[model samples]
Target: MQQVVIIGAGMGGLAAALRLQAHGFDVTVLEKQPRPGGRSSVIEECGFRVDTGPTILVMKDAFEDTYRAIGENLNERVEFVRLDPNYRIYYHDDTHLDLYSDPAKLAEEVERVAPGSGAQLARFMADSAAKYALGMAFVERNYTQITDLANPVALRRLLQTRAYQNLYRQVARAFGGSDKLAKAFSFHSMFLGLSPFEALAMYSLITYADLALGMWYPLGGIYRIVEDMLHLAQQMGVTVRTNAPVEQICIEAGRVRGVRLASGEEVPADIVVSNADLPYTYRHLVAPEHRRSYPDARLERMDYACSGYLLYLGVDRTYPHLQHQALYFSEDYRANLDAIFRTRTLPDAPSFHLNVPTVTDPSLAPPGHSLLYVLAPMPNLTAGIDWEAAAPVVREKLLAQLERIVDPDIREHIVWERDYRPTDFLHDFNAAHGTAFGSLSHGFFQSAYFRPHNKAPDVDGLYFVGQGTYPGIGLPMVHISSRLVTERILEEWS
Candidate 1:
């Protein structure tokens, strides 16, 4: 049996481990974190359970297919509840919108908010569905080379998808150029750490998935998915070792030999898979001379995704107005996005994703208490902001904003509090430029075959599975990436 070593027990790595193990490889997963679920890990504080990363799970088919590959039922292992009115959008106009998965209800809401929009909403859904179908087909598979872009069939499909239009434009045209509704639809790009104005129009597929497929929550929390994956991995006889930070990917004459842990233990393997942040992986783990394609200067020149400022609070009281997920848009949405991605500065008025998980899964908090997760998109570490000095000020402002928006005197009721900065993402996960998600933003040039391939260009027996590689970010995308990578490995080994 061929020995395989996977670095970073993220969702992608765990999934790859299971798939590769089933393929008859001896698989061992090494994680720097104390536990599994790289970005999807849970943070426990004073009995309050909060998912520090990836609060929502979308695209059920990808998740279902993953478990089905091993003849296991994901539903049986983890309870999934579909979220209707997926998210409550609190706009800058003091008006709120509830995004429903049901088309009829959504049309009604659109018509109510913006007159004569019911028909437009229907048309938008139909067009978005087409984009979703095309986009998923394009992303779910692997991209081996740049020439794959020139494939006639792929080009035809791409042209038909109108991927050249850009997401904000597509959404604006879909909603009769209504900025508010457009923003609601197009903002899904931010989930991938890309600005709607700049991210490919193909990404409108995200909004389609959310509004059409509906959002979902596991019974225990998002981290429950991680726990379940870990359980499945262990049951399959895959060795999973946590707190085993990989110091380097041991390469011998341009081929993977194994990995060296920070503890000075070297684990030998026939193949190495990395689910760590891509830029960081190439720059830090793989030695400079051995790297043929990604040199230090080239890695530094790459455009990375924006980071986030996260605030997790275990509050004594629940806000009745809060839903499972809510987003409070900054007054000037475009300007804030510019600040994060273009100017590389903190948003003076930050738009935030507010998740009150206790509303959906009350067990996450004690009786009468709630868990609030606030994530504000900010520039990555490249911005040079003094996080240690800025965190306290930002925390006060954020708490005040929450109080003003949701509850008065909300801060007084907080029983527990913790915050994660961009630097924390860098120090903890080796995330490039302190990006909380994964690799570079999904720009047109930075996406699809243009993104890093699962199989390294020059390194034999080395693979990558995670947000940095093809079929980029989001839990579903990572799942897809893992499957694609495992399939490649199986093919090569067979």
Candidate 2:
């Protein structure tokens, strides 16, 4: 039997473990934290369960594919509740729009905001759906070399998808050049940690995926999916351990031998896969001699996704009218974007995403209480702002904004509260520059074939899976990345 050691039991790691085990490889996953899930882990505080990262589960097909590969039905293991009017977007002008999965309903909302936009909305959805289909086939696959980008089928799809056009521009043209409608449609790019104005038009498929396929919430919170995968991994006879931080990847000559834990214990392996932060794996985990292309100097030049200020509040009361998910756009949405990605400064009126799971699952809190997960995207640690001082001031600002939007006295109901900053991501997850998402922005140069490959370029028997590698950020991407890596492993062995 071939011995395999995977570092980090994150969603990607767990998926990889299950797939590889089914392929007859003996797999063991080592996670540093006391629990699994990595960034997606649950935080149980004062009787409230909050998902530490990634609240929404977009693209259910990607998730279902994983279980289907192992001859199991995902629905039997975990139940998912589809959210209609997926998200309520609050604009600066005190108006709101509800994005629905049904095209007719969405067209109604679009026409309500901008006359004549109903037809445009339908056309945009059809175009986006086509782009999404093409992307799934040509773009999302694993890439081992630059030549992979030159495939004729992928090139044809790229042109058909208008991959050369800017996402913001594409939405503007499709929606009859309405700024309001364009912002609403294109802002989904931010979820991938990219500005819509700069992200490739190919990414507009995200909006299609969200409004067409719909947003879903797994029962017990998003962390429930993680729990399910972990349970499956252990049941499949895969060795899983927590509190085992790997200090180094043991490399012999040019191939990976295994990993050395922080406890000074060495574990031997015939294959090794890392689901840790990509830049961190290259900069800190692997020895300097083993990294040829990703030296410290070159890595410093790479652009990273912005981090965020997170607040998990368990309130004594619930907001009955609040949707399952909501985004409050700042008065100056573009300025807010500039603050985080361009200027690397704090936005005076920062936009925020608010999640109140009680709207869907009241069991997360006391019968009448609620759990609020607030996230404000900000510049990563590369900005050099002192979070220790900024946190309190920002918290007050966020509270003031929440008070105006949520209720007159929203702060009074806070019975329990906690926050996570960029520094915490750095300390806890070894995320380079405290980036909550992962390596290199999703620009043209940093996407698809241009993104970091799954297999390490300089070493044999070593691979990567997760947000930092190809297919980029988001839970669906991570799940697909795991499948891609597992297939790569199978191909290498075969």
Candidate 3:
């Protein structure tokens, strides 16, 4: 049997282990944290269990595919609840719009926001559906060379959909120049840590995937999927070790030997797959001589995704009126985005995502209580903003917004509270630049074939999986990445 060692037991790592083990390889998963699930981990306090990252789940087919690859059924293991009116968009002028998965209901809501724009939305979705189909053709496969991505058929589809254009411009034009509708639709790109104004129109596929494919929530939380995968991997004879931080990837004669753990233990393997942040893996784990392809200079020059200020609160009372997911857009959406992406400064009025999972699963919190998870996109550590000082200020601003929008005196009902900052991301996950989303941003040059390949270019027997590699960012994309890397490994090593 071929021996395989995977670093960081994240969603990508755990899923890959299951697939590789099913193929008769000896797989071992080492996690730095005490628990599995890197960003998708959980936070428990005062009888409230909250997911630390990725509250919304879309493109569930990707997840189902992962399970089917291992000869298991996803629905049989994890319970999924579809969310209606996926997101409630709260605007600056005290107006709100609900995004629904049902086409007829969505059309009604779009018409409510921008009259006579229902037809325009239908057109936009048609284009979005095309983009999704075309984009997934590239996303679901492996890329060995640039020609694999820029071939004749792909180029023709790219031109046909005009997916190379700017995302915000396309949405704005499709909505007949309605800024509200444009922002509401294009904001999906922000999850990838790119401003819609700057991201490519191909990203509108995210909006289509969310609305058309529908937004789903696993009953226990997003972490429940992680738990299930970990359980299955262990049952399949994959050894999982927590609190095992890898200090270095040992390479000799241009080939990976194994990995050195923080405790001075070395584990040997025929191959090593890293689920760590790509830049961090290159910079910190691989020695200087072994990483000619990704020198420190090139890593520094790479664009990283924005970080986030996360506030988790377990309140003593529940607000039944709040939806499972909601978003608050600042009056100056452009300025708000500029503050994070361009200027790398704090916004005067920050936009935020609010999630009250107790609305969907009250069991997450104590009886009759609620759990609130607030995330505001902020500049990554490159901005040099002192999070120790900025966290309190950001928390106050978010609470103030919550008080005004959701419930009055919201702060008073808090029984437990905790916050995570950019520094925490750096410390906990060793994420380069303390990026909260994927470490690498999804710029035009940093996507698809342009992104780092799953197999290492310099070192033999070293590979990468997760958001930092191709098919970048988001839970669904990470699941796809796992399969891509697993296939690559099997083809080469099996």
Candidate 4:
């Protein structure tokens, strides 16, 4: 078997190890952190379990594909409980719009909200579904070199996908004047760190993924998926060594041979796949001469996804009316987005995503208690905001923001609380400039064929996976990225 060394035991790295191991590669996963799962990790504090990041689940088929490829079935291992109302969007005035999984019920709700909106929603769903299908196919086809996509037909199809139009414009065209409908559909773009007005219309496929595949959650928590994937990787005989930070990718001539750990120990392999942040890998892991094409000058010009300021709270009391998922939008959504993306500062009134697991799975908390993850999209550290000064203020602001939209007496009911700022993401993940979700802005130059390469430009036999590369951010896309890279590795060794 060809030896494959995967750097980083993140979701992408773990998934890649599973796929490549099945393809008969001897895989060894090296994680710098003591634990696996990367962002979807769990922390226990004061006898309360806190899941710090990545709350909701979407694109169920991706997990199914991963297991099936390994001669196993995902549903057989983990039961995915389909969430009926995918996410309940709580408006500023305390009223809500439930974005449901069932199309008929969703349309019924649409009709209730705006006359004749059901028909518009139908058309919108149909178009979004097509985009999702086409997007997946095109996204998976590797453009290892930008010139690989010079074919005119591929170019035309790419343009036709509205990779050019802004997501907000597309939503406004379909759901005009209905602010609630527009906000509900365009909200996921926040994951990409783009305001609906700035993010690509191609992201409209988020609608299809949420409504069609159905919103879901593992029985325990999002972190359970990580544990499951880790279990599967280990079962396949892949050795995952944690707290093994790689100092550099040792390149001989023009190809990658292996990596040197920070401890001065060398772990050699025939091939190396980096699940690290792409920009960080280019800057730190690889030497300066090897980075001829992917230079800091060009990288500086690229738009980075926003970082997150998160608070993981273990509440002492139950929020009976809260759902599993909710978006607490402060008034002036556009201005708030502008403050984060454009101004690169905390907004006067920021919209936050809240995950109340107790509402859906009471087992996550002690009886009559809750767990909440409050996340806000802010510009990466590139904006140069003073996080030390802002972390506490932001945390308090999020609590206040949650109070306005959800529970009025939120602080009084708090059992335990911990907050994460951009600094934490940078320090922990080596995330470039504390960027939250990696390379996700869907700007003109940031599109697929233009995003970070799966294969390193300078070093041979060095490939990339996860949020920074093609197929982009979110759990499902990263899973697909792992699949694509493993296929390439299989072909290369064969």
Candidate 5:
């Protein structure tokens, strides 16, 4: 058996390990953190168990495919509760809208918010469905050359669906120029760390996937998926070692030798797969001379995704009125996005995501208590903002907004609180630019065939599996990335 060494036991890394091990490769997964799940880990304090990373799951078919690849059933392992009214969008005017998975219900909700928009929404979803079909054709494959993506048939479909248009404009035009509906739908691109105004219309595939396929949460929290993957990987004879940070990828004679741990131990292998932040792996783990395709200068020029300021609060009081997921859009949505993506500064009034997991699963916290996960998009570390000084002010702003939208007495009910900043992402995940989502913002050039390939162009036996590679960001995309990379490895190494 060919020995394989995988770095970072994240969702991508863990999933890749399982597939490789099931195929009869000897695999060892090394994680820097004490526990598995790099970004998809958990935090437990004061009787509160909160997921530290992704809160909800969408495009669940991608997840099901991963487990099925290893001859395991996903539903048999994790209990998932599909959320109704996927999200409650709180507008600046205090009027709210619920986004439901059922088409009739969603149409009703849209008409309630933007009168006469029900018909427009139907047309928009049809266009979005077409975009999803065209986009996924490229997303589900590995690109060996530009022709794989730029072929005539694909180009024709791209123009026909107008997938090349700007996302915000497409959604606005679809909804008869209703800014509220546009904001509600187009904001899905933000999860990929791209501003809707700048993202390509093809990304509406995300909006379609969210509404059509539905949003789901595993009963125990998002961490439950990670825990299940870890357990399954171990059962398959895959060795997983935590607290083993890889300091360098050892390459000699233009081939990967193995990895050098931070503790000075060398684990030799025939192949090495990295799930670390792509740019970080290239910049820190791989030596400069070996990075012909991604030199320091080129890496610096690459656009990174936006970071976020996160607050995980364990409240002593339950919010029965709160939906499982919610969002608050600032009055000036464009200005808010511009601050994060253009000027690279903190917004005066920020839009944020609110996740109340305890609303669906009371087990996440102690009896009579609830957990609040708040996230506000912010500029990446390139902004050079002093988070130490900015965090307190941001925290105050978030709490005040919560008081207004949820309850006036919310401030006094806190039992435990934790704040995560871009710097924390840097220190913990070695994420390039401390991006809270995945690194590498999804721009026209940074997506599809333009994204980094899984295999190294300069060094042999070196590969990458994660958001930094193609298929890009989100838990679902990362899962597909693992599958794609596994296929590449099997074809090449076989």
Candidate 6:
């Protein structure tokens, strides 16, 4: 049996460990942050339970595939509730739009907002569905590396999908030039850490995934899915040890042998699968001389996705009208995107996403209380802004924003509040430039093999997994990313 040491129990790390164990390999996962889930994770304080990352479960079928591959099913272990009014969008003009699971209802809503947009919305959905089919066939299933797409079929599909057309362009073309609608539809790039204007046309699949599948959530929180996966992995004999942060990927003669813990003890294994952030693995875990292309200078030039400033609050009272998910758009959308991605600076009036899971799942907060996750997408730490100084200002602005919509005394009801910023991402996940999602704007030069290789390009027995690698970010995509990387390793090592 092959002995594998997988680092970072984040979604990718855990998925890779589970897949390899199912392949009959000896797998032990080592995470840095005292537990699984690098960035998209959970936290508990004073009886307030917070998911802390990734409030929405966008694509769930992939999650089912993940568990099924391990001889179980996601639904059996975790109860997934389908959302009827999927999400509520709050425009700057104070107009609200609730996207429903039914296309007809959603179309009516769109028609209500933008008079002629109803027909445009229907056409957009049809086109996005076609893009989704093309995406599933030629894009999502396989790895994102150019080497994987080098196949003639992929090239043919490339002609079909036109991955380089730019998602923003497609949205603008299929629909009208309403910048607000464009920004709302194209905002999916944040999952990949890029602006809608900058992300690839392939990401149009997000629209398909959203309207086609609708949104979903676990009964407790998204963490329930993570707990289920960890349970299945343990049942499969995949060892999981928390509080054991992997300090180094022990390498010798260009081959990964094992990992060294933060405590300075090394455990030997046959291969090392890194579920940790890719840049961190390359820049810190591996020796510079053994690296192929990902040195500080090389990585420095790469665009990283926006890091976020988050405020997790547990309010002592309920605001019943708030939806499960809400996007509060800023008046200046393009400037906000440019500030975060193109220019790497903080914007004056930034758009924000608010997740009030307690609206749907009340168990997260104490009785009569609400849990709020306020996220403002900001430039990664490369912006040179001080998070210590920025977090409070952002928090106040967010409160002011929410107060306008909900109740004026919203802040007065706050029983507890904690903030997580780029600095936290850096300190906790060792994310390069304190990037939360991994890598930078998913652009022409940043997709597929261009992004980062699943297996170390130069190292003989090293592997990469998670959002930082091929298939790209999001909980579902990261699982797929790890499965592809580990499946290849199992095939080779077996």
Which of the numbered candidates is closest to the native, going by highest lDDT? 5
Q: What is the C-alpha RMSD of each candidate to the true structure, in Å?
A: 1.4, 1.4, 0.9, 1.9, 0.9, 2.0
Relative to the true structure, candidate 2 reaches a TM of: 0.97
Per-residue lDDT tens digits of candidate 4, residues 1-494? 67789988878888888888998889999899988887777887765666777877888778678878889888888867888888888777767788888998899888877778998898888878867865775676677676765666645655766645788878877886688788888887887667787877877878788888888978778787788888888788999999999989999999988899999999888899999888888888998888899888877777788888888888788867778888877778888888888887778877888888777677777777788888888778888889889888888888887777667898888888888888888887788788887755656566678877788767778999888887788788888888888777766668
lDDT scores in order: 0.87, 0.87, 0.92, 0.81, 0.93, 0.80
Tell me the tens digit of each residue's lDDT in model 1 across 1-494. 99999999989999999889988999999999887898898988787999998988889888888899888999888898898889888887778888899888888778777899888888777777877877766687777666666656556756876877878987888788888898888899899999998888888889999988878999989888888888888899999999999999998888999999999999999999999988888889988887879999989888899899999999898777788998988789899999999988778888999999888888998889999999999999999999999898778878877886778878789899989999999988999999977768887777888887888877899899999898988899988988999889988888
Model 3, residue 243: distance off in Å is 0.7
Lowest summed lDDT over 10 consecutive residues: which window, candidate 1?
148-157
- Stretches of candidate 1 off by over 4 Å are 150-157
How far residue 494's Cα lies from its native spot in candidate 4, in Å, is 1.3
Model 4 off-target regions past 4 Å?
145-163
Better of 3 and 5 by lDDT: 5
TM-score of each: 0.97, 0.97, 0.99, 0.95, 0.99, 0.95
User: Candidate 2 — what's its lDDT?
Assistant: 0.87
lDDT tens per residue, model 6, 1-494 = 88989888888888888888888889998877777877768988878889988887877887877788888867878887888677788888898887787988988887777678988888777767766766666435445344655566645656775756888887877668866567667777777787887778778778679868878989989888788778888788998888888877877887878889989989889888888778878888888888867778987787777888898988888887888888888877778888988887777777888888888889898899999898899898879998778877888888898898777898789899888898988898888888877754567566655667688878878888888777777888888787788777866786
Candidate 4 lDDT score relative to the true structure: 0.81
TM-score of 4: 0.95
Give the Å error, residue 420, model 5.
0.5
Query: What is the lDDT for 279 in model 4?
Result: 82
Give the worst 10-residue stretch by lDDT in candidate 5: 148-157
